[model samples]
Target: MTLETDDRAEAQPTARPSRLARVRAGLPRTGLAALCGALLALSFPSFGIWPLSIVAVTGLALLTYRRTLKQAAWTGIVFGGVFMFWLLIWIDVIGYDAWVLLALAEAAFVMLMAMGQAAVSRLPAWPLWTACLWVTQEWARDRVPLGGLPWGRLAFANTSSPFTPLAALGGAPLVTFAVALSGALLAAAILALRARGRRAGVACAAGAVALGVVGYAVPLPTGGDTAGGPASAEIALIQGNVPHAGMDFLGRPMQVLGNHVAATEALMAKVGEGKLPQPQLVIWPENSSDVDPYVTPEAYQLIDGAAKQAGVPILVGALVDGPDATHVMNEGIVWDPKTGPGAHYTKQHLVPFGEYVPFRSFLSQYISELKRVAVDFSPGDKTGVLQVGPAKIGDVICFEVAYDGIVRDAVTKGGRVIVIQTNNATYEHTDQPDQQFAMSRLRAVEHGRSVVIAATSGISAVIAPNGSVIERTQLATQAELEANVPLRDGLTLADRVGATPEWALALLGLAACGFAVWQRRRQPK
Candidate 1:
């Protein structure tokens, strides 16, 4: 242990590192980590597919390939940062600068997962840390800031993947967990294949693949529409195709309402001429009449006239002020041919900055140039279930369908059918319609309820209870799509049990993670 001996030790590499370690050490560093985040965000779009995901997971694996907990955390933040930065692009244009808070919040949640993987690996048998962390992160994202934003959960990418059967088993959270687990397992196998215990790694990777295969193979609940009495109900969705500027409807309320009315009239004429079947319910997009129906007599008459002409129970989207004058309720009024404004379902879930500002007065300056839409609509109550004679129509106005719990609660409490009363005028040309359309599809599957999307601008659809897009309208089209949406009398296993499965899995994964952490701490150092 002389100074000369120590100098010699420092000069000579102790033992030339193995090839696998050499590969890890010799890997070049680049801003590829940031690119991984971008591609991962892009994966949220339709046809994003597995290739982008492989790039993301591989990049994530590289981020952790040879890093410590601190380094992993920094890299994970980089991963989350590029991700949220891209995810929030709509938020900035849609102007909830407050979304910066949500992005930061979610990035921190991802860091927790990074820490979980970094700290818990010293144990003999480790749980899928990446998978567990991913599920937990999704749950967290959808839980924070007024019950959470369930928008960018990983399972969203698997909407079209065969792994969708996992949704029926435990909703999208389970699917997300399986996908991430498989990807991480694959990455581990690649690393392990180049090392000593490659066989076990291959087996682990195989097990993950088996879970995915089994997910696809399993038969999900089909207690939906079948050979039942009066199984189908005809419904029509009117896509008004309003301008990208949200309040454009108010300027041309006549044209907006005229567009929908003209479309409905033509559709019903087709039904009369035996060209198309009659719809029991004719639906219009949110803000098809943003004129205050409750407070304005003239407005109610206008809507009532339209409903009478349509010859069906109509759902009219309108802006109405509350009784107290302190707030306004973004609402959809149920109007019958005989009675006008029969029953009303108000929007429960409020947009953080869009419909109503979080700190309304303070943040008005940022979005003032685009019309005062953020302050126009009022927050609706959850108990607002539309009473359509013997049938119950569960309605979610604007962005409420984006929330799993909101839609679930509606169906659980007595809503047999779900309607998305959305005004997509704020996001006309972007990928918002497709993203929102995918969300409705996932909800249809998760809740065992049919969904009718009445988008103001375009991409309105009729989605069955099992996530199938039964029919949909083309983008930026002024038209109505009529479909016999099979009415589901029963709820899904997920609707009945709520997030019970997710919570149980989370606890189990967390316990395994905690145990792994404990064993790691106690290991001989």
Candidate 2:
């Protein structure tokens, strides 16, 4: 058991370790850090998200075995920095300077989380301290400097893991805790392996195995799990490749529509040629139909004809002028083959510099391309569900999949299938799709709902509730994905709690830090 130290004493600087000693204690090996990140990325994309996370976190913890709080922080920071630098390579597609700054901020946030954990090194329960520190940092990063960037989040590790069911309990937070704890136990096992006592090794092995066992016992329930009944509905995702991925192509609405028009015609030809299966509902990605369908009669007629020809419903990612003229909604409109148009869901979350500039009047003048390209499209009410065939679908436009609670609530409102229609054409990120794909997989685990992702320029896919990719198109290409989606009915415990994992960790971490500071303050001079 560890006794809390005085805050004053805790603040005092002690004699620092020599460079070689620090190295031995895992004080940031540039090579190892970079290698760890690459491994993490590699294990993902194909191997699933767990092994990489388990290895990365466990390795970091071992690196800090005999190190001080400061040195431990360095280890975590270096590891996180390298991971984000590669993981977020797509950001470079938009621009260099701004994204680089964003990466720095993101890395700093992760490092701070690590530092917080390091500060609690003397705690009796090191694993618990590590968890608290990590949780604390996650919350801070979510709120700091404007809103927050929740990219490269830890919960993504279990996206393909058997432990994915845990997301239903507390969203990503539960997953993060379990994964970290698994890593912590692994670190303990490593320590036990080197120990002279066989009992210690046995205990560590038992603990690690217990974590895995517990994860397995807590089975996840998919939204489809509680579905009133089971039936398959055919769906289509349209990929309208943009002229180019450059921001310079903005204001060219005609060109944007033209690209989509060409693609839709090709898809129709496939249907006639019997090259593609008949779809019950056709899904177009965000901005795939940015021109208001209500106003663009020809576009509406074109889509209507296709839907009638296919004899199905079509959920189109479109732009809608606000009712009061105060804003224009980045909207998702449901157009039935017979009904023309019915319900709609607007995009609630907006991307900075991409969708619209922050404080367009002030920030707009700073980023020249942003002024020309990024529109002042307002967020839509996501509460509304689009009627598709016999199913009521929720539309998660673009990166909205990144927001956990929002998607959960949609499912709560009886959203049978969550469809994300997005255009990744602007950011020709080679790795961006992989990162985005990873997040979507986790979403499947959390909500237990089938997800249909349609992206312009490639990587359009259909994901099953188990977080497995069913089918996907190649990148930088135009293709049509036609698949049957299962209707989802029930909500998980996590669906109700919404990202509780990071929140719980952040709260406890803060309390621990406060306690540590208090103890140090009370220490004698």
Candidate 3:
């Protein structure tokens, strides 16, 4: 052969490997992370497939594996950006700018989680440590600057999954741990399958399958489970449709109040006609009476009339011109048919910007949204265990249900059943209500209490002790959900354990990171 032919032949021999190298190059880290995030977002409410969460976490683990902390953080940011962007899209109803800002803020937490994940990624059974790290990250996220937004938690998404039983064992934190662990286990399975050892691959596959089987066998308490102490109370949940969608509901305050009052009266008429059983307690959604019943005589009379008609104690949600004129109190008032408003539970966890502007002195000048709030809503200093008729209901207003501690406190303080009073009028037909409903389901299992939700713009629901939806109303529809909810006085293991499992899991994650660092230092320079 000639010299020219020989050179061409040499180049041809190297062509296949170069092509193979190009093909073997994986997707960009951020791209993979974003894909993982999108998958995870799909696992939550409104698009709840649940199993997708495991796959998403597995994909994220692979992307993060052996990556530097900086790279892992970037991966987390991309992942969170995609996930939060989709999960919190309902916030766009308020403003696109606000939604984007909130998503970015939440993504920062994910970045922190990814950094910690990178630290322990080198450890043995790294998936287990990584899973614990997830719990820790969530734990931190749930309570940070301005008492973190607990929306989009893993436990909330797994409310209807086979893994929901785990909540009874260790509360939402445990459920979150189980989800992260399963995802990590799945990642391990994938890793093992790709390894050279056939036996390792088989073992991991078997282990993962076995765990899933075990999860199904977990003895979750059902509706048939006895309350043992508190008797079952017939409850009514009112979801009076708003006059108009969006913030317009705020403008027609009296119209909103009239709607709830009318719904309650209609429910009473059903009872009078022997079409429906008389409820021991009638619950109204938050902002059911935007005008303070205590201060506004007409509003008070409207609520009183409804209670009298039902001939039952009515739990009315009211926005009261508070102890100070510059602020208001979002309250759940216990109104007796015989008497007026008595013991009330003021909302403990107020929405940061929606209710009150944080750093108001500075933010008010720059952001027009602050002006919309007008007056701040004050946070109550106590738990929301309310005495209504024969039962004590744990009343959490609107966004308070997202906070684990708030719900748990009421149960601990002798709330036999959980009640969530919310006004989703602004977010009607959005994923917002669906997501909140998911939290109620998880809380039901966590505390082993029947949860009754009263929403102003529908999605009102009665969740069983086992996290099953007994009954739920449609979005933006005028409806009432009535059920003989078992008043569960008994506390599940989750209630008793409180934050221990979360703290322990967090410690394990930190220990793994410490060990990883020590091992790295011990290695040859």
Candidate 4:
């Protein structure tokens, strides 16, 4: 080849644009994205400025509007990173390095969704499409790459907000869509006002108000209402203090088990003395017995003794000798006062890295913490619904409460009361337990079932079907709360249409993107 031709080829290669050049082009938008993320994170538990969720969405929509795909994607990454980092700061309790890795991985999904938002921003009624796009993104993130982490979801933040009633109509996805749509409309109104378009601004403002009306119009069966069906029986929730917080709780397995048994016995003493009313059933926190109660005679005898003394069915959380030798099962076993151990439900949605390391052979080479879970816990196939005394309880263990399907199954499959058995010993004093408690509250409202959360080191609570906490305990304290929790058999609209609303909304967003692409191509150059 001629020297001139070779020179031209080399120059042409540079003209194609280097990766650094492409990335640098989007750099200016990064600050806005990060700011949007910070606002979003602030909307969740602990900070819980509920309106901030809507504001964050508005910021994201405004930042991505009229931006190129590359710029939008960059904005999404920065936004997602900031939000996930803040939301999962509790993960640092495990290992800072692990927390950063997980946060980055989750941020990539948000980045993908942001690109779609940019694609349809030019369309008429773009805000509506963009809002649905947000729902689609959450739907994808919640179930991808080994069961997606549903933490930091917008719906989880709206537990106390006026928009929460939307959850009763169509579950978490609908609540998410409503919040996002309001934000998008508000953003659109602001943009129109900036352009001096009074008519357009007024229309967008009206649209935002309309969302509030619709949310309130939706018949949300909240508060102490008979809409939850009927009162089943009184239940007691025990929060037994652990020996110490963090992973050390596992090291003192006997103490953790002993603590729960002792707490139960103390409550019974109150009942016998007529200081407290008798509970039909008692619930214990997960990992309350790290020692396999079935295999260890000491653990079994201690549990049996507690059940007999309570004179009621006690749902005990225990680590059982697994479905196999290399794996353990985190299970909720029902101990009958007269018959001993009976019906059991093993946790279905095990935490990805915390419970079992994915790609363990490769990941363990770098992450030393992977070895901490020597034997992985296997997931159960069935939903956690069991009959105990006068109530049919739908039990979800630990992080399983964060998953929609896991929580939904219990309600739809004949569970009158929702019981969440969680061991927060590792996350004591961290916002992690508070964030989890928020999820339980939302679940209580979404399914129209009273939720009872029993935790180790602490934050145990009893929530009404309306998502109101009737009783609760403090962290690192041994406490017992007894309440006449109503058992509601009626399912909310969100329950009857399991996952359909999410799927339909997702399809609508995808269609809008397709149409936007077609419209863009047909435009004259």
Give the number of the best model, judged by lDDT. 4
**Model 2, TM vs. native:** 0.85
lDDT-based ranking: 4, 3, 2, 1
Task: Score every model by TM-score.
Answer: 0.87, 0.85, 0.92, 0.93
Question: In candidate 4, which residue pairs clash?
Answer: none
Q: Candidate 2: lDDT over CA atoms? A: 0.69
lDDT of 4 at 77: 92
lDDT of 3 by residue, 1-525 (tens): 010112244335453556555434433556678888999999998999898987887788777776667767888898988999999998877778779988999888888778777777777788888888888878877887688988878888888887888888888878787778778777777676665666766766665555455556666566533454546889999987787778667555578889888898888889889988989889999989878877778888888888888888989989988778788999999999998789999998888878888888887787666677778888899898888998888989988889888988999888988999998878876888888888889898888888999988878998888788889988878998788998877788888988899899988887887887788678654
Which whole-number lDDT from 0 to 100 does residue 232 have in model 2? Answer: 60
lDDT string for model 1 (1-525, tens) is 010112234446578789798556433332566777777888886445544664576567645653456756766787778887677656655555555766787777766666666554433444376667677767777777766777777777777666666776677777777777777677667656656577877797787678668866655433345432345577888886654454344455556766677777777788889988767888888878766776667667777777787778888887777745667777778889896777787787777656655655655666563345534456565655676543476888766777667777787877777888887766665566677787777777777778888987777888877677778887767777888776666766767778886776666667766876676467554
TM-score of 3: 0.92
- The better candidate by lDDT, 3 or 4, is 4
On residues 408-458, what C-alpha lDDT tens digit does candidate 4 reach at each position? 999999898899999988988788988999989889879987899999887
Which wins on lDDT, candidate 1 or candidate 3?
Answer: 3
* Pairs with steric clashes in candidate 3: none
lDDT of 3 at 347: 94
Off by over 4 Å in 2: 1-50, 63-76, 192-198, 218-230, 248-252, 255-277, 322-327, 359-369, 523-525
| TM-score top scorer | 4
lDDT per prediction?
Answer: 0.69, 0.69, 0.82, 0.86
Residue pairs clashing, model 1 = 142-148, 328-378
lDDT of 1 at 93: 55
